[model samples]
Target: RRAAAAQGTSLYEEEEILLALIGGKDYNDDSKCKKKLEEYCQGLENASLKKKEIHEKLKDLCEVGKADTKCQALKTKVTKKCTDFKTQKLEQAVKNPSDDNCKENERQCLFLEG
Candidate 1:
């Protein structure tokens, strides 16, 4: 449509308009998908950080005393974040299994799981 409007004569075919719309939609979808993948990556990083913090806290508590009162809650938080990260990556994989991002996420999930 923009291409047609920019033309000196302003002549445009219906098919050209439709194709432009379709092309724009495809570009938008790709952009959105890339954004989603970046968000998932950030989520995974956050979850890893949370889990590491919990581990460090647990270590500190163990060094200071034998009390484990807060251990369960911390464990639950780590588990939940790990699960959420994995779920997002898995969903991305299912959506675009052949994509590099999906494959990288799969690898990251496996590493995180182990």
Candidate 2:
């Protein structure tokens, strides 16, 4: 995180969440790392906003081309409280990649964590 921040790169949600999974921080009810999850949420919110802006820009530029659904959906998107259950499950899968069941879970975790 320090390296990335120093380089002007972001820690990103995945990295933060990974840190939480690895017991990098101390917290009560650490079963699900809230701080890490919050970072990811912030990142996602920022991304959703950026995507919305890009979609509008694209729509303006094209005039007759396809507009970005990602942006469009975001415009009318509903914010919801994230359930930590999913992350909890996936974090274990990622850490224990040696497990046979984790093979597919790891693949999925990579996708989700990204």
What is residue 79's positional error in candidate 1, in angstroms? 2.5
Q: How far is candidate 1 from the true structure (C-alpha RMSD, Å)?
A: 22.2
Query: Which residue pairs show collisions in model 1?
Result: none
What would the per-residue lDDT of candidate 2 be over residues 9-111, giving only the tens digit for each residue?
4434432233334323332233333343344445546766554554222223222221232222322221111234355565565566566645334433443
What are the Cα lDDT values of the candidates? 0.40, 0.37
Which residue runs of candidate 2 sit more than 4 Å off their true CA positions?
Answer: 1-65, 74-98
Candidate 1 C-alpha error for residue 31, in Å: 47
Off by over 4 Å in 1: 1-61, 66-70
9-107: candidate 1 lDDT, tens digit per residue = 232232222222222322224444334334433554677644455423223332222223333233344446457766876676677677666434543
Backbone clashes under 3 angstroms, per model: 0, 0
In terms of lDDT, model 2 sits at: 0.37
